[model samples]
Target: MARISYTTVSPLTHSLNVTKRWTTSLGIWGVGAGAAALLFLSVTPLVRREVLVKVPVLKLYYEDTTPASDKPF
Candidate 1:
């Protein structure tokens, strides 16, 4: 018959390992979230300004060509 030896892990060591894994995953997620937030903040103003600049053009396209006197309001 052959004898097999099994290694046992301590609870504290297991907990520490779990904590380390969670910390690493959270750290990576936090960095990604921060980068996304920064990108959004940086792009938001530019997008808003661009939309603002184009609003008059859009309004012109949609504006009624009929004389104001013909309008009901």
Candidate 2:
């Protein structure tokens, strides 16, 4: 009978990372919204209103001047 010898293997280790928390201030968003509102108010009057004019179609052909050779059957 032969005796078998087993060796213990070491486990792998991973590094842990820590990140800082990010935050936003309300002043920037408020100023941006205010500027956008001011720009929209200032540009509103520059846009012109569209007006459509209806016109009648004119036909300028006489039936009496039709040639016999060029007339459609």
Candidate 3:
């Protein structure tokens, strides 16, 4: 009778491979999130500012009415 033992890949090798994959995935996710956040912040402020500026602000000058104001279309 003979005792037999078998081992596959080493535990250290498996853990290192797993770590490499996890880091790679995290790197990709971080870049994607940073880009999305930048785009959102950059575009939202510009759109809001444009909208704010477009709103009509009427200033009535009681002493400055001219003939152009009298002409009606």
Candidate 4:
């Protein structure tokens, strides 16, 4: 009697494993970058008007209270 051993590895899983072993700080950097992007976008009128203003908790914090005369844009 003979038995065969089959093994399979996903390309994504392999690359992720390599990345995990290569550096532990990679994920921390990625999170920081994402937060930076979110912070930058949060001040934009498009994001404020279309997204942030809809959140009850954040709406007050993001709202623009300056008079039109004082606006630089």
- Each prediction's whole-model lDDT (CA): 0.71, 0.41, 0.64, 0.87
Question: TM per model?
Answer: 0.43, 0.27, 0.41, 0.44
Show the colliding residue pairs in model 4. none
Candidate 3 C-alpha lDDT tens digits along 9-31: 99999999999989989999999
**Candidate 2 — which pairs collide?**
none
On TM-score, the candidate that comes out on top is 4
lDDT of 4 by residue, 14-65 (tens): 9999988867788789989987886889978898888888989988998889
Instruction: Write the number of the candidate with greater lDDT, choosing between 2 and 3.
Output: 3
Rank candidates, TM-score, best first.
4, 1, 3, 2
The lowest-lDDT stretch of 10 consecutive residues in candidate 4 is 19-28
Residue pairs with backbone overlap in model 1 = none
State in Å the error of residue 11, model 1.
Answer: 2.1
Q: Total backbone clashes of model 2?
A: 0
Tens-digit lDDT string for candidate 2 (1-73) = 9999987554432121111121244566888997677556543433211111111221122113557899777
Angstrom error at residue 25, model 4: 18
Superposed Cα deviation of residue 54, candidate 3 (Å): 29
Backbone clash pairs in model 3 (N, Cα, C under 3 Å; residues 3+ apart or in different chains), count: 0
The parts of candidate 3 lying over 4 Å away from their true place are 1-5, 8-11, 43-73
